[model samples]
Target chain A: MNRVNGDAVLGAAIVVASVLAVLVWVPRDTGSAIVEVVRGSMRIGDALAPTIGFSLLGIAGLILMIEARATGSTLRLDRFDLVFIAGVGGIFLCAMLLMRWSGPLAAALFSDESYRNLRGTLPWKYVGFIIGGGFMIGTLISLVDRRLTARVYLLGFVVALCLALVYDLPFGSLLLPPNGDV
Target chain B: MDYVLLGIQSVFSNTAMFSVFGVGIPSCLVTLFLGLLTGIAVGATPGLAGPTAMAVSLPILISVFGVRPDALLPVFGFLIGVMKGATVGGAVPAILFNVPGTPDAIMTTLDGHPMAKRGMPRRALRIAHFSSVTGDTASDIVLFVCAPFLAIMVERFLDLPEKTALIILSLTFISSVMGSSVGKGLIAVALGVLAATVATGQTFHPRLTLGIDGLQNGFPMVSAVLGALILGEIFVTLNDIWRGERQASTVQSSHGDVADGLQKGDLRRIMPHIARSSVIGTLIGALPGVGSTLAATLGYTVGRGIHKRRKRPEDPDFGEGAPEGIAATEAANSAVSGANLIPVLSLGIPGNAAAVFLILAADSIGGFNPGPAVFNFTRPQINPELVVAFGIFTLMALGNLLNWTIGGAFMRAMSVMSRIPIRLLLPIVLMVTLTAIYIQDTRMAALWITFGFGILGFFFRRLDIPVLPFVIAFILAGTLENTARQAFSATGGDPFFLFRSATSVIFLLMAVAIIVFLGRRKGHGAAATHPN
Candidate 1:
C-alpha cells in the first residue's frame, strides 16, 4: 500500500470511530444531560465539541493523504506489516491480560487465608509474572535471531524471579497483577 | 545575598539525609553516587536513554525514600547525577560500535569510531570523557549563577497573563521547531492538550472520557509518559528486530601504548573546541524546546569552521579521526545536561524530555514545585525550596567530579555492555516499567492507560510526528488553563484580557513570529528537496 492508501484507510477508521463515539459510546441523558459550557451564567450545549474536533482531525488526515499522493512519495506497507502488527499487538494484549486477570482468578481458587496471605504465605500472583515475563522474553529471543528453545523460557523465568525478589524483598513495592490484599 | 548564603548552607546540611529500615543513609551524596553509576550503565547501552533510566527508577526511588520535604535533595541528587553521567556514557558505545547510545551521541560516531578503528579506543574514550566533564562542569556553573537570579526576576515582574502568554510562546516554539512539519507538531500538541483535559478540574467532572468509568480519574502521569516514550520505543525496536532492519555493527577493540592517554599536544588542540562548544551548548540549553541533538550538530559545525581556518599540514583531516571532532560533539551534548535545567528551575518550563521527567518527579514527590514561587524570599524568612534547588546544584557538581575521575575507566567496560542483545534487554525494560507504574499508583487502570498510550506513541513514531510537543503540551496544559482563567477573571471577564499586559502581548507576538518564521523555513527546505 502506498502512503495515500494507508492514510486514507486511517482517516476513514478515525471518522468511523468518532461517529461511533458520539452515537453509541458517549453516554447521553435522555432529557437534560446535555453538557453546558458556562462561565458566569450564560451557557450552551458543548456535547458536540469532541465530535467536531474528531471530524476536523479526520479531514486533516485526509488532506495529508491527498498531499502525499500529489507529491508521489510512496510510504509503502505490505501484508507482512499487517501480520507483524497483529502478532506484536497480540503479544502485548496477552501480557496485559495475564498481568491483570490471572492474579484475581488464582486467588479465588485458594482459601481465604491463603488469598489474604498471598504475599507472605503463598506466591500465587507471581503466576502473572511468570506468564507475562515468559511471553515477553520468548518474543524478544525470537526477535533476536528467530530462535526459540526451552533455554529461552528458563532464562526468562530466572530473570522474572530476580526482578520479583529485588522489588518485593528489599523495596516492598507493588508486584505485577498486584496482591489482592492491597 | 541572604538567600545565597541560606542556599549554600542547605547544600551542606545533614537534614538532606534519609533513613532506610532504621539506618540513617546520607541520601544526597550516596544517592548521587549510585545514580551516576546507574547512568553510566544505562547510557552505555545502545537502546536506553537518560530519561528512560530516570523514568523507570523514579517511582521506585520515591517509594524507597518516602515523599517528604526532607527527601527532596536525595531524589534531585540522583536525577541530576543521571543527567550528567549519561552524557559522558553515551560516547562509549558511539566510539566502540559506531552506534550511538543516545540520540545526541550520533555526531560523536563520525570521528570516535574511526579513532577506535585505528587502535586508539582508549585515547578516543579519554578525549570524550575529559571534554564531557569539562563542558558539564562549565554548564553547571552557568546554571548555578543564572537560575537563581532568573527565578527572582520572574517572581518580581511576571503576572498571571504574562505567565500564561509565556507558556503559549513556549508551546509554539516547541511545536514549530520540532518534527518535520509545523502542522503535524501543532496537531500533536492539540491532541495532547485534549488528552489532558479528560477527568481534570476541581469540580470532579470528567470530559473526553466517552463515559468510561476508568478514565473518570484521568490518566496517571507516570504511566502515560512511560508508555509513550519508553514502551513505545520498545515496540518500535521490536518491529525493527522482527523485520531484520538493524544490522550488527562493531569495531575491533585493540590495545596500544598510544591509547594510554591524550598527549599534551592533543589536549592543546582540542581544548579550544571544547570551550567554544560549551558556550554554544549553554546558550542553546537555556532556551526552550531546542534539545541536545541540535546543540551537538551546531557545535560540530562550528568546530569544523574554526578548524578549517586554523588547519596545519600535519593535522588530521576533520572527518578522518580528529580529537577535535570528539571534543566538539561531547562538550556540546554534555553541556546541555546541566543547562537544560535552567528553564525548568527558573521558569517552570522544561527544555526537553529529560527535564520533563525531572518536573514529573518533583510533582509526584511533592514539597518542591519548579516555578519562580519556589524562590520567594521575604524580609526575615527564607525560601526552603530555593535551598533544596541549591543542594541539587551542589550534587550536579559532585556528579561532574565523578565523571572526571571514574568515567574513563568505566568507559572501557562499556565495550562488553554494548555486546548485550536488544532482545534480552528490552523485555527487562518492559517489566521494570510495568512494575514502576503499578507500584506508584497501585491501580490496574494506570497500566491500561500506559498500554493505550504506548500504541498511540508507536503510531506517532511511524507517522514521523514529534512526541516532544505532545508531551510538553500535556504537562503544561493544566497550568496554562488555570493561568488563563485567572487572568480572565482578574480582568472582569473581558475576552481580550490576554492582551492587557504588555509582557503578555509581547509573548503572544513572539509566538506568532516564531511560527511564521519556522513555517517559511520548512517550506524552503521542502522546495529545495523537491524542486520541479
Candidate 2:
C-alpha cells in the first residue's frame, strides 16, 4: 500500500462517513430494523449488527489505508473498486434517506427486474450506465500487451456460457416458486 | 436404536446401494484411470495442479446429481476418487518432465527430476508410487472414522458466534499453514468472503451484481469456482507462455518394470513419516476452512524436522529426489482432502473455500443444506444414509488402497505416462470441464459466472487479493440478517430489546473485540495486518 497517508485519509473518509451515516440513520430498534430469513423477526438481539459488520468492514478499509501509508504503498484506486464502493454507498444513502420506500429501490438494485419497479427512474439508469462505463474503461486499462486468441477466449467464453445457459434453461424455471404464489 | 438397524437395512436398499457399487465403484475405477492420464499430463506439463481435477469434477457432480437426492453419494464418491487419483497422477508429470503436476508435487520434482535427468525415471516413479500409496491410505482411514464423530460433537456446540469464530480459526489456521504471508492468507479469505457475498439474498443488499435477477439466487458458486480456480490458472498459463516460460520437454517412454525395481524396504522405510503425516493431516482437516496447506506444511516440516540427514550420494539428495519427500507430501495432500470434510460434515460451516461451495451443493441436493441440526438430530431416515456413507467410506478406503498399491505399481513406468503436454492437454481439460459443469446444476449462467469469476480469481491471485473474507461474509450474511430480524420482531421494534439476550450480547462483544484486534498493530511495528 503506497501513499498510505492519502489512502488512510481517503479510506477514513469513506469508512467513517459510511459508518456514521449507517449508525445515525438506522432505526434504533435493532430488532425491527434488522431483516431475517429463517425466523420471521426478532426483538432486538443485535441492534448493532449491521453497524458492527459495516463498521468492521470500515475498520478494515481504514487499517488497510494506514498500512499502505506506513509501507509507502498505494492501492491503484481504479474506477472499478472505487465506483463499486460508491455505488453501494449510494444505495445505502438512498435506503437511509427514503426510509421504507427505499425497499423497492433496494430491491431494484438487488433484483434483475429492478427497472420494472423503478420504470420512471431514468436518472438512476444513468447511474448504472456510469458504473458500467467506468468498469469497461477499467477493463481497457487492465488489458495488457497480449494477443489472447480471440478464438480460444471466445470459444472458452461461448462454451462456458452455453453450458451455463443450457443448465439453467431446463431448470431456470425452478428459480421461481412451484405454484406461482410468492 | 433404529440408526443401527437402519444402517443394516440400507445395505439391502439395492436401488441406492447399487449405485455406490455400480456408479460409485466404477467411478472410483475411472478416478484411477483419469488419475493416471492426468498424472501423466500434469507430470508432463508444469504449473498445473491436481485439485483442478476435482474442480472440473465438482460442477459435473452438481449437474448430474442436481435433481436427484440419491445421486450425491456416488457423485461425491467419484469426486473423492478423483481427488486421491489426481495426487498419484501428479507424480507422473513430476517424475518424467521434472515438472510437478500439483504444487505439492514440487518436492517430488526435486529428486524425481534429477533421477529422470540421470536416466533413472523408473526409479523415481517407483519411489513416488511406493510412498504416496502408503501415506494416502493411512490418512483416509482417519478421515473416514473420525469425521462422523467430530461432526457429531460440532453439531452440539455450533452456533452463530461460534461459527464465526470457527471461520476465524480457519483463517488463522490457513495463515499459519502456508508459510505464505498472512496478508496472502487474509487476502484469500477476504476474496472468498467477497465471492460468497456476490450471491447475496439474505444480506442487507447485494453488491457487484448490478440489478441482475440471476444474482438474487446468488453467484452460481460452481461455475464461479471453476472459472476462478481452473480458468483463472489457465490465464496465468497464457501469461507465462507470452513471457516464454520453459515448458517440460516432451519425450516418449522406454518401458521398465514399474515397481519391481524399488527395494522392498523403501515401503517400510517411509512408514513412520507416513503415519506422522496422517495424524497431522487429520488434525488440520478437523478444523473448518483449513485446507491442504496446513496438512502439507505440517507433513513437510515434520518430515524435515525428524528426518536423519543421511549422507547423500552425489547423484542428488532429499531436496532433489528423496522418497521421504513423497511420503510427507502424499500424506499431507491426500490427508487434507479427507480431513477437510470433517468440519463441513460435522458442522454445517465450510472450513475451506472448496468445502464452502460443496456445502451449498450438498445442502441444495441433500434435500436440505447441512447445518447444526443435521448433525445431532435423527436425520431424514432415508433407509440408512449413515450405512450408505459407511459403505462409501469403506469404498473410499478400498479405492485409496487400490490406488496406492496398484497405482504406485503402475507409475513405475513413468516413461509411458508423462508424454502429454499442456498444448494438447488444455483442450481435453476444457472438454471434461464443460461436461462436468454441465452435469452439475446445468445452469449456463453458472457457467458464464464461472468464467467471470475465473478472471476475478486470476486477478485476485495476481493482485494478492483475499477471497476468503468474501466467502465467509456470504455464509454469515443470512445468519446475521435473520438474527437481526428475529431480534427485531421479538422486541416489537424496541431496539433496546436486543439487550435482553445475554448470550447474543456476549457474542456481539467478542466480534467487536476481534475487530479491534484486527485493527491493532499485528506484530512489532509493522502495519497491522488482519489475522485472516
Candidate 3:
C-alpha cells in the first residue's frame, strides 16, 4: 500500500472545505455584504469575519499541504483505527438512542403517564440514563478489557446510578440525560 | 490603593458567608479549600489535570451559585485554588512512582524518583512543596504588581486599532510558537476562528450556520471547549488503550520514614535554586503560549549547571537524588501557575489552559470582565471589577497559606492516585462530562456539539495539531472581530486603519515577522532533517 501523508490529506480537505465555505456557504447563508454603508456611517457585515476566517484557513491549508509534500512526512491511519472509531461511534449512537427512547418505552409499557410527564419523577427519571449510561460504560470497558463480565456490567450500572443521584439529588433545577429531552 | 483595600475587604467581608455550626464562614475561603483538595487529588492522578478539573467543576459551581456579581469571588477562589494546588500535587506521583502526574512534572521525576529510590521520598515531597509554594507566592506578588500596571498602561495608551493589532500579534505569536509545525498550528487557529464565526456577531444575521437552527445560536462555549480539550483527550487515550499502546504503570511505591523530613541546612542549600527557577518560570509564563514544560526544562538545566560548579565530592550529581534538582523543577513549574494569569487578567489573553478556564469562568459569571477596563480606578465610584480582582488575589494568598500549612501532608497522602487505572477512570469521566454539559444546557444538542468537537479534537491530536491555539483563537475571535469592526468604523472605513497609528503598525509588522521568521526556521529545520 502506498501510504499518504496525513498532514497533506488533512490540508487538502481543509482547503476544499474552506473554498466551499467562503464562496458557497458564506454567500448563501449570510444576509449582508462584507462591508455595509448605511446612509453616511459604515458597519461591518455579518459575512466579513467568516470570509476572512475561511480565506485564512484556505491559505493555511495550502501552506500545510506544501510543507507536507516538501518534507514527505508519513502519517496515516490504518484499519484498526478506522474500526475503533466506527465501534466507538456505533456505541455512542446506540447509547444516545437508548437514552432518548428508553424512558418513553418503559412509561408506555408500565406507567399510566407518558415519559414527558414522569421525567421529573423517581424511577422513571432514572430509567433511560441508568440503562443507556450503563450500557455505554459497560460495553466500552468490556471492549477495552477484551472480556465480557457480569461484574463489569454491574460496575457500569452502579456508576450510572451514582452519577444520576449526584446530579438529580442535589439540584432541582438540573436534569439527567434525555430527561430534559423527554 | 483604595481599590486594593476594597478588594481585600470584599474577600474578608461577611457579605458572602455560609453558616457552619452556627458560625458564619466566608464562602470564598470554603470553596478555595475545597478546590485545593480536589486539585491535589486530580493532579496526583496520572491522567487528570487541573484544567480538566476546572472544566468539569465550572458548570457545577455556576449552578451552585448563580451568575450574580457576588458569585465572582467564590468561583474565582475555587478555580485559583485548584490551579495552585494542582501545581504542588503533581510532584507526588513523580517523586514516589517515577510517573509524572502532569507534563510539567516530567522534569521533577528526573531527580524526584532518584530521591525516592534512596528512601528520601518524604524529604523530596517536602522540598517540592516548599519550593513550589515559595515560587508560587513570589509569582503571585509579581502578578499583583504587574497585572494592574500593565492593564493601566494599555488602557491609557492603546486605541481600538492598536488593540486589534495587538490581538493579531498575540494570535500570530501563539500559533507560531506552539507545535512542531507552525502551519498546523495556524490551521488549528483558523479552524477555531471559523467555528466561532457561527454565531451572530455585530450584525443581525448569524454567519456560517448552514441554515441549521441548532447552530444559529452557535455551539455552547463550555461544551465546545470541554469537548475539544477534555473529551478529545479522553478519546485519544482510549484509542491508545484499545491499541494496547498504553498500560498501567507497575512502579512500586517507596515510602520514606519520618526521619526523611528536610534537615536543618536543607532549605539554605535549595533557596538559591528556588529563587533562580522562580524568576525563570515567571518570565516564561508571562509570555502567552510558552508553558511550564519549557520553564521546568530551562530551570533544571540552569540549576544543574550551578550545581556542577559547587558540588562537593560526597554530594550526588544532578538527577542523582539531588534536592536542588527537584527544587528547581518544582519551583519553575509551580511559579508558572501564578504568572500565566498575568496575560489573562491584564490583556484578556489566556496564556495557558488553566488561564483559559479562569477567563471562561469570569466570562460565564458576569460583572468581571478581565481587561484594562477591569482596573479602572475611577475614584469615589468604586470599580467592582477591581475589587473582584483583589478578592482573587486574597483567595490566592489563602491558598498559599493552606499550602504552607497542610498542603504537603495532603500531597504526600495522594501518591496512591498513581496506581488507579486510567482506562477505568476515563469512562466515568466521559459520563460525568456528558452529564455536566447536559445539566448546564439541558438539551441533547449540547451533548452532540460536545461530541462533534471531541471528534475534531481527537483528529487534531492524532495529527499532532496543537489544540491550545485553536482554543485561544476560539475565545479571542469575538474580541478580535469587534475591535477590528470598531477600528474600521472609527477610521471612516479606511482599509489601512491598522497602519494609521505607529503602535498598531508596529504590532501588525511584528505579527507578520513572527510568522515569516518561524516559518523559515521550521522549514530549514525540516529540510535539514528530511530523509529525501
lDDT of 1 by residue, B436-515 (tens): 78778777677778878887787777766678888887888777777866775666666677798888899999988986
For every prediction, compared with the true complex, DockQ reads 0.27, 0.08, 0.63
Q: What is the lDDT of residue B54 in candidate 1?
A: 93
lDDT of 3 by residue, B64-122 (tens): 88899998898898898899889998999989888888889999999988988888888
Candidate 2 chain B lowest-lDDT run of ten? B523-532
Q: Of the candidates shown, which would achieve the greatest DockQ relative to the real structure? A: 3
Q: Write candidate 1's Cα lDDT for A1-182 as tens digits.
A: 55445544654565566566557543341111233335563222323334433543454454444434333222334665557667767776777676555665677776565444564434775766666767666666665556777777777778777777777777644555555324
Regions of candidate 1 where Cα sits further than 4 Å from its true position: A1-82, A101-120, A173-176, A180-182, B15-25, B202-204, B248-259, B530-532
Question: Comparing to the true complex, what docking class would candidate 3 get?
Answer: medium
The better-scoring model by DockQ among 1 and 2 is 1
lDDT, residue A28, model 1:
49
Cα lDDT tens digits for candidate 2, B1-532: 4554543343334233225535522433343345444443443345555556566655545554454665555555555555566666676776666656666676666556665665566666766665666666666667666667776665565544444444445444443233223333444444454445443433354443545777766666556556666766665554444344645235444433333346566667677777888778777766665566557767877787666464345423456656676667666666776666666555555666546555555654664354444434354644334554554465466566667556665554444445555543453354445346544544545545665666675555455444444454456455545544554555566555434555545555654554346434332234433221
CAPRI category for model 2:
incorrect
DockQ rank order: 3, 1, 2
True-structure lDDT of candidate 3: 0.87
Residue A86, model 1, lDDT: 70
Stretches of candidate 3 exceeding 4 Å from the true structure: A1-4, A69-77, B14-22, B202-204, B254-259, B524-532
* DockQ computed for model 1 against the true two-chain complex using alpha carbons: 0.27
Q: List, in the given order, the native-contact fraction of each candidate.
A: 0.14, 0.09, 0.61
Best TM-score goes to which candidate?
3
